[model samples]
Target: MKLSKKQARLRRATKFRAKHAEKGVERLCVYKSSQHIYVQLISACGTKTLASASSIKEKNGGNVVAAKKIGTEIAKAAKAVKVTKVAFDRSGFKYHGRVKALAEAARDGGLDF
Candidate 1:
């Protein structure tokens, strides 16, 4: 049977996560919606969140610009908490457009992935 789009995306996410888990590094996860973009830095053990940021308060939360802002915010938060390295987890979203912009912005903000 063919999977639905959401199911397909989730499948890909699961596969990527399995590989990431093996490295046991902190995870930088990104989730985007129609009106918001959320990011989190999860602990290496996967039991806690070290830092988080979102675009909920932005005038246009779903755009690339908002995503970039959120990325910088997350990077700053991670630095404040002394987290400099993490594995980027795009959550199965294609690394394009807003996702790409966010990743680049985070890099500029001093997070190493």
Candidate 2:
């Protein structure tokens, strides 16, 4: 059976998540859409979200700049909750363009992922 693009991405994501789960650290999960990007800091056990940010609040959602803003905001929210380190979970998206920008900005904001 041939997998659709979305299915294939999910397969990859599931595998990656399994590996991350083994590490037992909090995760910074990213999800992107045509109009917005969302991020959440999830507990190691995956039962709760510690912090979250999204581009919906920004003036522009579909740009790299907005993603960077969301990333920085998420990092601040995480720090407020006393979380400094986390595993980056790109949700099957490649680590480039907006995704890369967000990750880099998060790092600059003192997130140790």
Candidate 3:
């Protein structure tokens, strides 16, 4: 069966999750929409999310600036929860625009990806 755009992205995302799980590293997963962006820090076992952040909380997660702030927020929250390094799972989205901005922001905020 054929998949829609979001479904295809999910399918590819499952593979990335599996790889990260195999490595037993926490993963920083990002999900973006037209008006919002979400990020989650997943445990090494892929069993739970350690932390999460999004632009929705700030009412402006759609742009690069908002993406960066959300990234920093997630990173700080992860550190508070004792998480350090993490694999970056872009959820099949290309590494540019908001996604790239968020990732860069996370890195600058002290996350190793």
Candidate 2 positional error at 3, Å:
1.4
lDDT of 1 by residue, 75-104 (tens): 899999999999999999999988999999
lDDT of 3 by residue, 1-113 (tens): 88899899888998898777879899899999899999999889888989999888776668899999998899899889988899999999999999999999999889997
* Model 3 bad stretches (over 4 Å): 1-3
Per-residue lDDT tens digits for candidate 2, residues 64-92, read 99998988998899889999999999989
Off-target runs (Cα >4 Å) in candidate 1 are none
Please identify model 2 stretches exceeding 4 Å from their true place: none
State candidate 2's TM-score: 0.96
Worst 10 residues of 3 by lDDT: 54-63
Q: Which pairs of residues collide in model 2?
A: none
| Candidate 1 lDDT (Cα, 0 to 1) | 0.92
